[model samples]
Target chain A: MLGKIKKETAERWGYMGFKSLFSSGIYFNVFAFLGLVTIAGLAVGLHGTYTGYHNVYGVTRQIPWGVLISGYIFCVVTSTGLCLVSSIGHVFGYEPYMPIAKRAVFLSIAFMLGGFIIIFFDIENPHRMAIYNLLSPNFTSNMWWMGTLYGLYLLALIVEYFFLLDQNHSMSRLAGLFGVLFGVAAHSNLGAVFGMLHGREFWYGPYMPIYFIVSAMMSGGAAIIFFSCLAWKIDRTVLTRRMERAIMAVCQLTILLIAIILFFTFWKIISGIVSPEKYIAIQAFLTGPYAPNFWIAELGFGLVIPFILLIRSKGINTNLMFIATGFMLVGIFFMRYDLVLAGQIVPVFHALHVEEYSSLLLYTPSLHEISVVTAGILIAIVLYLGGEKVLNAHKFQKHAIVPPGAFICQGCGGIHYMKEGESQDDALKRHHRMRKVDREDEHA
Target chain B: MKLTNIDLEKLIPENLISVTKMERRAFLKIGLVITGVFAGGRILSVTSNVSEAFASGKDFVDQYPYKPHYSMVIRQGLCIDCERCLKACKETNSVPDYGYRTRILTKIVTDAVGRKREFIPILCNHCNDAPCTRACPTRATYKNKENGIVMMESKKCIGCKMCILACPYEARYFNAERHAIDKCNFCWDTRLSKGEKLTACSYVCPTGARIFGDMSDPDNVAYKMVHQVEKQVWVLRPESGTKPNVFYMKATRSSPWDLRKQDGAR
Candidate 1:
């Protein structure tokens, strides 16, 4: 299996000549430029942090968390979503999800790393955290579980990707199983980090953890459509009939997920308004400081506009799919941002009527904070482009992705393997024709 | 009025004896009527300082979470915003200029006669159910099980600041030098651990406004002051459920509010 992959890799690399690399398009060049700029920006952010976060970050004592935390959650939620959506084909053996497996697995790893980068700069004494998070393991802490599980999830995914590359079917599936288990645990635990904070009236509840998983699937579905479109554009490959069908299926699934999220969001707002304890926060997000974030990004772009476009296209238009998914991806980012920031904006002592806390605590992410997040995104782009070049992720054999026992092949008497240099249907046809020739030879 | 629980045998700190003998006798009657003073949630509704003293001193002596439930009582009527306690705390703890371990809050209420001002000193609650301790991911901020003081383990802190948000008192702040969150630990490190009987703020209060003592010890002045059932006792933001160790009352004697304590503490 691995030998077959090596031969395929060589064939793909033969086409990737020095001239082809240098003659990359304007889009590729922009990503390269972005990568360099963001790297420089990340260095500046780190330097500012080293001097003093108080001076560099816009976060005050009243609001310690800022856009950095929001961006971290955005990246991670997308990563978890990709893993779950991709596993539909790789682990569960759904043919429609098969075309996206390789790209999905690749992007999942890339996005998780991006998340780690954003958070690494935001946390003070990150070096100490690395040492103590292990030594002084707080078993009850949701943050501890989140960090540890994501670490394990990353390792499992890397192994799964390696196994997939080797075409080690059983081992890859086993690794994928581990990846899914830990990914779900880590993602929901990330939700628990905020959900468990009873002191935070806006965030406290069971909804966050459940919403995280559901939204993860939605984010995953949208990401696959968006990136798959980009991959086709980058690799200059036309989407085959099968690949287009796969994307359409995912598009429909994304539409449904968005509806679920809309329902959840609607009820969340309603309940928050009904509960007087959380009324001030509801006001803060809906019609107050975060109104634009809630109405424009989360509602309009994230859910409403994208939902209408996908429905109008009837899940059939490729360009419409791309545009909708792109909007969803961008809009979902603000969803995470709005949630994280809104939770902390209402000062804990707001009810006390103190002069110090007479108004809502103000916070705006400084330029340094924004730079670090931009760098994290740039890193994801670089990692993704690197994966595409090195792994030939776009060239995954769609036929081979079918999970065992999911379908009984009508061709070749229900058998499901191909001979050397033969596609699944061609191998079955050749074998059937040979049997008929053998029978005629016996009659003669 | 013979108050059954007002035991006179207790050893009192000199600073704790702010009220005169006549005021102490009147405290029992004052305590009986002040239970409803906090109902309207206005400082002006409290009327006389004697009534506030009556309301603040109720239900103290019976309940104690630890052997020496380290506690504090503030006589709000006597506070003149001298900021002596704040200055003393800064000196003792090396608190930076931008940060403080303790601060004062002011409220002005207008009556038919004129506008009256009240100052409330705020500090860490050292709560029995401390939200900060539970919220700290690294157990960096923890409650001292022995003293019930919420203390910071600076080295363990990653400066997550979750504890700051969790603290209903808004008492915690980021200490850049320590690379951790800083808060009032009831002078636990600066004075209490060094065998000092009083917190810096309580010791320096010139009008004898701040009372620091062990609520669990029957002989402590704080225990005596808060034990009367007739007087209503309340903590700030009781709805928060922190069960703060700090208590508040009004001065029994009608002394004018002034910055006279500034020279005494510095």
Candidate 2:
């Protein structure tokens, strides 16, 4: 299988013609394995009868919340991030990103699909929730808005991707516009879920919406780079110098975002020091049970290290960029873990401080929960890879590339040939000859 | 009526001291009854004169003031932020796994000492005027007429997050898994509807700090305590006058006091 892929990669690189990567038996086996894992995970998750753990389960009265919430946040946050990057690239006319725009759109859709699956496993009665959200329509609820917006956003992304695939630029642009707007709404609402929780000191406040948006943008950029680089490597294709420059710019933006995130984080911790209720939360992240997670996973691995790697003025090294991305992904996972766990680690009755508190108030994700997260990640990779492979199968190459020539037009600028190796001057001459031939044929 | 020390001593002999005390008590009662009858008519007239005051205000048992029956109230001071109540409520109520019925909030106040300190507790003040209900487009979350508890029928929720924004105190939570709104309802199903005295929070309170009772019934433990304990009390984010049912005898400066403070924390 490795030899075949290498041969195919070399052939594709030499422009000798590419094969259907997904059609191979080896690819089928990987897909089958992923499907099996998903099924096993779902079975384990559904085997439990209780929505929350009791005395028999790992979660105790000391820690009410567990890993499920963090996983859900992870899926949704990634989806939001993908949507933002895709929309900005396609709709905003970021000319540098034109080559990757369609792939980004495809990724946006794939991420949302994965997110829905994760959330589906977490729900106690998904069917009932579906029926109720549509039938009952609780307009006042934040979750309601989030659900509605995500649905619409997904639809918009789908439309945009299809339009792009079909080369319907006008329709694609329209869909992209709507997708961007709804994407913003969906992510902001997701943040409001935590922000509106006046009860959780860590989650409360206006900055939640802003934090979510900025993080989404940063993560989205990181994802695009990571995935794009991977695709380029797999296909043995070098990105055009222009495309590489754009990727560099994206890396710069991502670094700037990390800096902003750091500033906000510093302020967040500092403010926590002043307020008693939130102080407990800050302390948990700073030096409590989850302190190691915060220091190492979120700060050291996710932000600090990634920041150092990406902030170089000369530009990021491609290999180092991938490493940083891996670190950020790992770190972000921990950040989500800390966000959910720190809030619940401290018991409600710490005021009395009477009981001998157990340090094991901590919870590890059940096999089922971990399986669900794994399924989401698998789904994203498989979907993205499969789609790219299929498109490549259909992407016929030109023997010789032709550069565009400038021409005057009334409504828009130069109308160049959509097909490769075709010049506008040749097209115009061909049109005139066809017209003259048609006149002679009519006279005959 | 003793005429003098010598005369009184002569009238009430040392042997008859107990009997004399009983006789005087009877005489005092007789005098009180005569005055009560006359004062009853005067009190009726006074009630008529203070009709507006009577209409708006109920009489206080002592120097303490009367608090109205708020639909959603939280005892912030007594809350220990254990989150047990949130879990119990979620399980008993079948709240979505990724959601919460109540949240534990913590506030940090930095003082001139240049060091930071904090206070934390669970909060779900069933407000007398709930903003969540008002913000709902479909009215999925409604205040119960029976106990004034705000209940949400998940089936009807459309997953619009408007209510989350409307809540001034940020009491609402989004069940991302279920795609519905979930929040504390004073344990209406297992506790309030069953005529149970208190919620899980009040039950799990090891210090007996949280006292739950009918505000209308003066004899209720919560009512009596509020009146008896002359401690300074406060409400979370007092500016959002939703008239929360929950009261705190003493609120910390570090607590989330308003939208501004909440924003600052984030």
Candidate 3:
């Protein structure tokens, strides 16, 4: 009975079939290897859990958050970004943006799941957090809000994806709207988790929330382009002309957001130098131990080099875009690391001028921590690959056949009339073109 | 109150009033007499020598919200690097070897002449507006309604360590055995709950360095010491704006050790 239900569901969803996952090929070998690494990493995390986090993790009383926190941030930031960027096309109805929407939604859920897995290991009493989060919710806590909102956002994303698979555009659009709302709120709260800490001078301010939202957009734009490019490389049929246009559009957005991030970084450094408490942490990034991470990874790859490459590519060169985004993903990972660690390197009592706390505290991620972080990245990749095979590369109908009484315009929310034998795709394109002409005429 | 015998004229020149007005005002308000000026008067070393115990202004003593407002007052200068408080606290709380419920921080002034070494003993400040309590997602660590002691519900702790990062004072540590964060709870569990008047650290302190009592009670020594204007009473990291229950004041050699005797008699 279960087998029959599974087959029926698979047939309805247009799954490529489970046999595709088991087929012998380079992709299969790669998937198997990633599965192995993920298992091995999870095993290491479990070992850490069994042996006490204190013994396995590098985090001390001074530096309570470590690389695991950064890893989790990296995953969720990308997930939020994906949700936001994809919503611009699907939820809000931009035709060029629509091509990447389905895959982006799937990847967003995958990345968020990766984030959850990492945090599950990082938290000492995950079971307690689950119970008390509902039983004794602290409304004032940014952590609580971030966790709860992200959980809801994930739910919205899953529902949205399910409806999209069913070709139920209106329901999918509604879910996507909720997903976007929850994603933004959750991401900003994650920033508040760091920003609201008055004790950590480096992270304290309104800057973190704003930065988080803006950077998530930047991260999202780069991610969609990167993964979309990878998807095209994996299978030639996946890259439609519309999808290419969508990647180009995202690439342009990525460039603009990167410039904004660069501007934010410049002011952050200057302002940090002026504040006595923040100066110590900023100094660490400038010329202290984290200088390499800041100069090479965060500035060079995260902002500068990617900015130059994307500009040179002019959102046209797919290969260059691919390479630039790969560099960006790595750089952004370091950016999160620097953000979390630099805020904590200066001991809390450093201002007291005590002999014991005079110097900046140091932390190096343990082998166990590295393994857990590795697992998080692999989990996202493995899920993406699995999603591709199961969801038939997340391809949708070129032109959705609008059901009777379902032809309301997505752009203006007015009823759209289709002329004799006019397809939904052509009607959308014509309407958008006419709107563009009207906008241009108004500008003239 | 008795003035110290150290000749102020010999230590700081008569013309040392060239110090900044703000510095002078701060010194006077704290009842500290300037003892040494160095680095072209950029650095000032001060010692308490007030003969009269000034009545604390009403504005300085805010109405306590908690009935007991359990508090600790650290006599900074009197601490002589003695680890009896540390030893006693560990024994009472069963603190692990790697962790400390309370600790003494040493500050050395190379330029100062008379007292070069000062030890500051620090524990959980039990701040009225504690960042840890605010940051805690599960309300695992919360301020007690009755006494305002920041107490931990260990079973509720998820050990995300957000509280540790939020704390301005590096007071808390994750206790692996309990699978929760632990810190000084003013000996409420081990001593105070059992009707002990003093915490183990304060009771074992040789020089009355750690004074534990109710800040809300006007008759309590902790309340009196914090309320009085005779000495420089300050909390660590005041800029953090935690409004900590723990207070600090200097204990000069000239003042006889009457506070310890008073507590011992009790």
Per-residue lDDT of A165-216 in model 2, one digit per residue for the tens? 6566668878888888898898888787667655455676887888888888
Error of 3 at B178 (Å): 0.9
Q: Which lDDT values do the candidates have, in the order given?
A: 0.77, 0.62, 0.85
Least well predicted 10-residue stretch by lDDT in candidate 3 chain A? A397-406
Clashing pairs in 1: B55-B232, B60-B226, B61-B227
Which residue ranges in model 3 land beyond 4 Å of their true spot?
A1-12, A398-444, B1-62, B254-266
Mark the regions of model 1 whose C-alpha exceeds 4 Å error after superposition.
A1-28, A398-444, B1-63, B110-113, B249-266
Restricted to chain B, the TM-score per model reads: 0.73, 0.60, 0.74
Per-candidate total of colliding backbone pairs: 3, 44, 0
TM, chain A, every candidate: 0.87, 0.79, 0.90
Worst 10 residues of 3 chain B by lDDT: B47-56
**What is the C-alpha lDDT profile of model 3 across B52-139, one tens digit per residue?**
1111223323435688879898988899988999999999999998789899999999985445889999999998789999999999
Question: What ranking of all candidate models by lDDT puts the best one first?
Answer: 3, 1, 2
Candidate 3 overall Cα lDDT vs. reference? 0.85
True contacts kept of 2: 0.15
- lDDT accuracy of residue A362 in candidate 2: 64
Candidate 1: tens digits of C-alpha lDDT, residues A360-424: 77788898899988888778777777566555544554345554433324541133456666676
